[model samples]
Target: MTMQTRVNPEVRPGTPHQMGAHFDGEGTNFAVFSAHGTRVDLCLFTPDGETETARVPLPERSGDTWHGYVPGLAPGTLYGFRVDGPYTPDRGHRFNPNKLLLDPYTREMAGGFIRHRALYGYKVGNAGADMSYDGQDSAPYVPKSVISDPETFPLDATRLRRDWSETLIYEAHVKGATMRHPDVPKEARGTYDGMASDAMLDHLTRLGVTAVELLPVHALKSEDALLSRSLVNYWGYNTVGFFAPEPRYFGPEGVAGFRRMVDRFHAAGIEVLLDVVYNHSAEGDHLGPTLSFRGLDNASYYRLAAGEPRYYVNDTGTGNTLNVSHPQVLRLVMDSLRFWVQAMGVDGFRFDLATTVAREAHGFDRSGGFLDALRQDPVLAGVKLIAEPWDIGPGGYQLGQFPPEFAEWNDKYRDTVRRFWRRDRHAAQDLGSALLGTAELFDKRGRRAWSSVNYAASHDGYTLADCAAYTERHNHANGEGNRDGHHANYSENFGVEGRTDDPAILAARQQRVRNLLATVFVSQGVPMILCGDEGGNTQDGNNNAYCQDNPTTWIDWDRMDEGLIAFTAACSALRRAHPVLRQTTFLHGAERTADGLRDVEWLDFDHRPADWSDPALGRICLHLRGSGESATGNASTDEVFLAFNNTPEAAILTLPKQGKGLWQHEIDTARDAQASVSVEGTQVEVAPHSLCVFVCAGETP
Candidate 1:
């Protein structure tokens, strides 16, 4: 193919108020931020994104922003930036005009990043290391930012503002969740259109999840290491473009596919939450590729070491941490967030490695610029904001330290639930704290119970089935010699390691999975179900399947566990049906004025007050009633009883007789179905290694 210049369009000084390629119907304005750049050239490419049509210099620079206007450029025009400045790495001015840079606010991307030697600003295997600058054109290897008009993909303004207490989150991956669905169209599978397909919507609706927290959907590039091993970044956490959706998930409708999916989710009464990666860019460390941020303004975009500007602050464990404390960088993040909500129609965001973004000069600040900005933003404050709350850096675990507007993923809940079910010593006390929404961690700031987003398993770890079927992580497929994932996974295999035909072991594993799911739903917090856990999805013990893009991470619909699915739906329905299960107020065993009953009563197997100090006690029960002081205006008058037995022997549990109605059995983890039979007496048998739920049948006191 011959490289030819199709048009030498007239370039004039444009306004730098907007930070990306914006189309005003007749023409397009291009603007980019590069604090230390001496010159910026807007490289426009052909329709196929193969040939470079023109390189128009941005005629003006206003306050670190370079901008230019093209009279004939339209919304579909493909463009990138080539910035020229000092190539010194030690002083943090690694500006190389040879490398094509992506606009930090690009709404849509054309083509994908191809790992090539030219992509690196420094010469490979150079004796001088990063000091040796490579004079190679990287335009062919990088993705081009597309000129976009937000009005082109119009979305509904109506949002399903579901209450936190009533929200049931289902965390899923865009491709992994829909790739293998039989009902999704063959061509649409693994795309946004497929996820919003009738079959997927029906499944989500049936599961009773109010919100779908999707894995990172931002445009990302596979790392060179993974590519060398014939693997890819399946999780999409290595973000290259913060504003654009992953082009791989776009169907024939292109960027509009994401908007259509969100619209469909809203129509089905489900909110869409994105797992965003604002903590870092895809560009790794000093030796990593010069993809976007590094080539544009290395010092302004990344938090370089104070004394060693060449080395990056690896707080995210992804080589480089984003300098969110900087005013311009902060603006970029805020703008990206608003664009997603205002243009893409997403309900909220789950910030990945949240602590890194909120870190300041000293350490992780509870009132950091990024956090305070989100809390004060008019568009973001009303929407749901969740935080992973931890990073690999020092003082990273700030689980409950986020502001009141944010909900946090409770890893303590996950570990405690797993350890308690596995019968680990001294876990019963922790289990008590977890079931009540870990009040010790989150209750300090007058935060509600729903602030703790509870989950037994998440995308980063083993699946619910794998938790019961594997004793240790088998992440050998990740090419790290089984050392890539977490070592202490709190998992067990019952008797066998992998697959087995033994009915007893299979039954036990199924019961354990049910117990974990039940615990999540029955707990007084927002429940987040790992997508395929309800249907017994396993990764063959590959806990960290972030690199395995094949069936190892994809949900296999063919092997769907029908009974488990029914049980999961029943658990979600039970939580939804009873307001007592989803309490907005933190129950601290306080007395309720409505019925003269305690909001929560911990009981022993013998129905007496629970011996909470006993380390050997593994069986316990909870009596839950709606709180009179509940933040939710309409307090529930219903009562619920939950019995958990992790011991080898069954426990005879006696129910409280504080209510006037008979107790009806609602859930039994030992069995696959809901036992809707009314209890004849106050005493019931709780099967070993199982959980049971009973509700007040007729009337309250």
Candidate 2:
């Protein structure tokens, strides 16, 4: 006879003393950590969403954790908790029993939300204040918390270590990326497996990028406004579950399909990084419906107003900011990151609006628990961490202010480079700062040059083509009466707006694209090129295309411009070949001679020393003499020199004398012609908005 123990409800305090749901093999152990709760009840629901099976009272208490376990309850069971705590508004406790809650550890959820007045725990028609209680059934409208099968989950591991300096990140949307791809099977399209297909992998390898940064793969829900407007949140910024992958992105096999994709990416020597949003959720403000964290532990998970606990602090400019200062909330974030890298076999993570994740009582701290835990964690320390280091919070514009362990998206580099090539006044100084890895911003402590992730056009704004062809954001299709998106685009339309038949405008746009590509590749930082920037994909000037999941967001592989593709390939190849372009260490102004010449030299219009105070100059040349350091820390660096002309008029650049060995023209963005050998010590004429890189052989000094 096998012995069976009859389990009862046990309540106790968890870490940080909020609440937690832990799963054992036979049954799930549920615990909640509300400090002021007078009573706690665990509500069990049926699998089909109709019946209320049981209302068991939590029995045991240990510190702040209130725990209970049903001996027969297994994985896939639906459960929630109702807490009865102080209704104090000024003291920050808003626990009510009428609302249905979601388990924090829930791994899977089904169906869409049914919006109703019953979703809120407070009375909707309270004459004086919202403090009045309302007796309503929120179970029919609220989403149920699903217990996950831990046994079926994949093992989380930190593998595939790619160096940050050598890393090339490719940002992609999981669903929209493969939704219309011709080669992907119909069933697999818009799924993780489709992105993991041979067709996608082949394209990534051929493009020479090392990492693929996915745009928000976590489980998310469409906003109520979007649902009513017949639009959708295609970008998945409104996170529903940080621990679970959006099930729709997985194929017929569900979770296993995502695992397979991670395995394939690892096998192909390509790393996968998720763009995670920890700032806000689909649950909005006081008027918003009760969701997972709101009903279960609203006061713990959200940063509510000082005098009114129900009113939330909107730091993300979305709706509400997560209360990251709370210990349980911090644990949730770290746990989610670990699960992805371990269970999914992913390589790294790019945190979207990461500033919100690091906010403490004082302000955004570099040593905040979330950032500190990631830096100290053995699993996460080895993986890459990229931060979009800003939000709508006070003093949230932290570009290079992140800890030394992470890389930040440098919007300064983006804007400055754009203004320089677009022929804006006094842009030379700004361009010089960006090209030199923005030493003013990032040359601190012992951080390397790669700390800055330089990109001209990313997924958020106008594409590379549109950057040179649209002055204002054209977003009429967004249905906001053309009153959405940014006005200060800093983009020049060359000659005309939208598509034009003028050959000169078309030619200038293509050349400017090359110019921007050349600047990114040659700049002393990690360059991230957009997916379709190489072939000039346009969104018809829609800068804010987050909701546009149609052909506007898809990578148009059919109508690719062959000439631009060749030019982009050439630029990437040049960047890969030269060590000076992607140096891990910052260069000093003091001249250091190696291999018979200074490692780097700044050349003026006459090929002399550049004048720092010069106000009228529009073009300058950068003379990089190789230090013979190993290229990308592998092979010996080849001696090379480059000339850049940003002025509208063509300029004659005097080449450094080359004697015993011939100088090979490696890449010349000024012309479509292939590279050729240069005549000895001859003056190389560079076209307007053009650059050239030449390689030469020389003995060590």
Candidate 3:
């Protein structure tokens, strides 16, 4: 079963074109990039990868790449790189030949990362800090890269390539979404195979989500600080290997399990999108351990400070920022993206801390090198590209600044919708803008309504259930004294904090959750629903549960709210049934020449034109008509009317008159059922802190 060959294979000069270990039937070629290293050695290991068997120096060097070939070595060969270079931390060169470095282009990894003092390049308690070099061999503590053949696991499923206008994204974690499912096999739970099981597929298909945006699946290492506290980076923001999939999520078939999962998802008509974190690595600050990147030409791989090279430019809140501006680093990212699409069969990507990748020396740029490369890439241009759009660096919040090719996560929409439901002052005006795709911010640059990815709750914040049941964050379990997450959550506790048994308070909380879900589905954008939000899942008010991998973060399938799930499904079906709701064109209240009807209309409670300057207004009505220039090509003459009331008192709203059609009640957040009564009068009373929807019935006006 083992693929290990003789202890010492015949070595030959290999070409430097390929970056990583490539198996070409007869032998395997090993290549790695190291700009400042004087020598590069390829270390071969046993089948278990616990001990080194041979060390052969690369016989050739072309430009910055060192390469060599072994005549008899085949796939599954365990190997790693050791580069010899200057060890000057102050000048930003932290290469140590003693440390075993992982190949940046590794497709699979062997063994596991063992935390030890030998992993660090410098002595633990030396007075010179990183300047003092340590000569300990780290092969026993580090993982070895495995030579893999892509042809072994071929992906034949066709890409779904769902259009942006019709996408309803369900953000989920690979393990959290499947770990608690009762029907999944015991051994498959929390693995890639579990996500593709029949139970999971049925749940997602029944919910009507077009795509599932998975959290990071890239290989990562937990921080030393979190390991000391018995916690981990559950969200996977800390990436260690871009090419290798996380070994922890692998099923019985290893890397092939990921391919099968993607194929199954595609067969079920659900696209898969990965949330990628290319901004930084798992290595921490200047006092951090010398991982792969730090040990292999640190000055070329990372962005060092201008005058003081000992420290790194903390553009990302993480310890070191990747120098994506560098040509080789940029190539590494692009290669990884293409490999995922062509070999792995992913439909799209969601970039975390995206601003850090698009930033130049000056500041965040829409046409920066990284963004420009993506814009012109033949393989990437057609795929879905989304950006988190912000970081903690100087001038990092670059919302609505990306090119037309990319959609952005709109935090403005989230805040506005939350504040409106919480009855914040002047929130009505902003709420209207949010429902209209925030045209003031994204209408320019030829961007369509789908460019705004609207969501009320995401992974980094409180869940929708917690947003209605708790005002203060209960993150004491995160071990940060509850000071880690956002303080102003724009949430309301109804009557009591955390959980309450009061019937009235519980009713209020349920209504608020329904209202929020309704708002997201009816809005003109690509809507994203947080996983388990539809089932009324809560993290015990732990808004910053990034490190909790227990029941607190996992979705409890047995305790789901069935009524809320049905309501969420109904909202999604409504959006899919109406083309006017998911238009690619932005509506600006402009009259359509085809029917002489305005695309959108705003009104007050008395059916008069809404006063834009009214700060005390808590009620607003929207009338949406199909645009003649709708890009979907299925736009009909049908119309929709929405009424939102955040005040403490009920209001009588007048419905717009249609010539030959009558309005039918479609949705009411105050109740669970789809109220399908035909309107008999022009005036309808809307309850306080609720929303109502009416659709045109019979004929067109």
Candidate 4:
């Protein structure tokens, strides 16, 4: 029996310090937690993911944890578990030794997922369904979690210190960002090492981006349903191990390679913010595979039906929701987060479907343990905390409900801005509110203007090119018959459906792209530009290209749209230059003697009060004068005037004539040539669907 030993429960506390896994670098003591298992067997496997070496039962059980000390076993040991118990699904006990389980605390996973019937716990044929047990060994197919050494990385080796406010996040994918790069070595392409190379860092530095918000780097598996439909989950929203980086991104190497990549990013001034998927796991539903969590303690880890423990409460729309309300489950998440922040040296996190993380018995509590823990954490609190603040659950549309410290992905700002520039009727008034950080939604709290993270395009939706080329989502590439992505895109093709040779159509599209980008950066929130938006990257109208690992989604670095590239560079420069555009506080209304004009005053063509209800007033000028002389306090000193025109035809506006300083052109996105026009006078012409910003002459603003 492989020199087996057993220690019963009801002895000691289930703490890390008390676990048998704590050894003094001589050997590893194995400890696996299982709240409801009668027998927990630690199954060892070969390094090649082929043969099973041994199966040893954990000797000690304390509180709810099962553990045992092994003399020879160390860091490179490939191991999994087979918790022996009843195969009763109705009571939420789906334990079968036939199915191999990954450790929840696994620091590294080795192989990619191979779809096979052996990976599932129950028998293939289905009269008894999951209730029926199978005796077939699944050791040949499933990945074995490795035992990690706490001192694997030196303490001072890989950590980065990046402040939250100084953060400029560049959201990208580990695969897609480097999959087709010509400069990256062929063997290293589409890997973590490729993304962390000096070339990648140089590109980021040139763009002046601070942090790289990587799409889910967690270990993941494609759902059986999506696999059946011939599709893949490229965005990796489905997570398997919270503590492990996807082995694929590690390339052919493994955990050692990933550690090297983190070290490289720190060497540069860049930080890594992982996009985490804690709401749900890759195991879809009760019908899904008996992976780590479901097989171990299904009833405790997941939210089960009121009467039927076998059936899960599908709050995540992925068929199973993790019960973070449970104390142990909550601790698991906290532990995983701390491991990444402290060990991996990740600067921050962008929570995918974060609303699900905050859900409890009452509602989506902002004060839930997950949110509260992260908020109170000394390390996590200093890093950027961004939330995609919605899920497919009830009350899931929590756009601005996150705590003041977090920056939320503002879909409303993106949608409203898209609709407004698309010339949709009745969208003009709301544009002002969105531009001002949606005070109607995020104002009342102690939240600063950065609370709303605005974007015209992101990974989930249409690219900037598609937003100007497709009226509806053409997601047929996802292989779900174009039914996967969102339908109401609020996009408008200028004059053609896809790419066109017509100069008029192309010109209009380019101008619209600039207009959209300008609006996002100039808006009163932290603006996020989609990875390839700078160069007019297109998905061929596939709004949800989540499955495409091919070049269809990879950035075309060589063939960048010159005009779009130049415009994006200019836009970024303008945002960094002007503090008036990205202020901490909301701009108050018109006041007296402030540059002999109101701090901000609305105007029409005739320089008169803009009619709030006037349908004809598609154009308006917002004259903004900043009160702060320096970065420290608020005092009206710097003067900035913005002329905005949404009309098809240009409108003339009377500029604010004061301050003896001539207006210096900062940015204008109307001309065919990507150039700025500096002219100061009582009257100025505003181009159609274009915005222009001017700074005072002889002033470095």
Write down the lDDT of every candidate, Cα atoms only.
0.89, 0.76, 0.88, 0.77
Candidate 2 accuracy as lDDT: 0.76
Q: Residue-pair clashes per candidate, as listed?
A: 0, 18, 0, 4
Better of 3 and 4 by TM-score: 3
- Whose lDDT is higher: candidate 1's or candidate 4's? 1
Provide TM-scores for the models: 0.97, 0.91, 0.97, 0.93
Ten-residue region with minimum lDDT total, candidate 4: 1-10
| Least accurate 10 contiguous residues by lDDT in model 1 | 629-638
* Model 3 local distance difference test score: 0.88
Give the clashing residue pairs of candidate 1, or none: none
lDDT of 2 by residue, 135-217 (tens): 78787786777777776565655478977767777788877678777888888888999988888887777667788889998
Give the C-alpha lDDT of model 1. Answer: 0.89
Task: Give a tens-digit lDDT track for model 4, residues 1-701.
Answer: 12223432222222344322433475566666678888988777667767676776777777787876666566877778888877788988888876788888887776667778777777766886777777767666667787777766433434566644345667899888887778887778789988887677877776667778899988889887678877778888888888888877777555667767777887778788888988889887888887788778887889888888878888888889999888878888887877787777877789888999899887799988888888898756577789999998889899989998888999999898898888777677778788778877887678887888888899998999899999978877677788888788888887789989999898888888888988887777787888888788898899888888778889888876876777776777767776777777666664634244455666666777666686544776666666434545445556667677888887777776664657767778786445555675667777888887776664423
- Order candidates by TM-score, high to low: 1, 3, 4, 2
Tens-digit lDDT string for candidate 3 (1-701): 13245556678998999788888889998888889988998888988887688888999999998899998798888898888889889889988998898988898898777888888999988897778898888888888899887585343435789998889999999889878989888778888998888988998988898899999999988888888889999999988899889988887777888888988999999999999988899887787887688887899889899999999999898788999998889998998888788888899999999999998889888888999998899877688999999999999998998888888999999999999999888899999899999989899989989999999999989999999999899999888888999888999998899888899999999999999999999999899999999999999899988898889988998888999999998899888988889999899999886767799999988888988788867889999998884455644576899998888999998998877778888889999666478887688999998999988886644
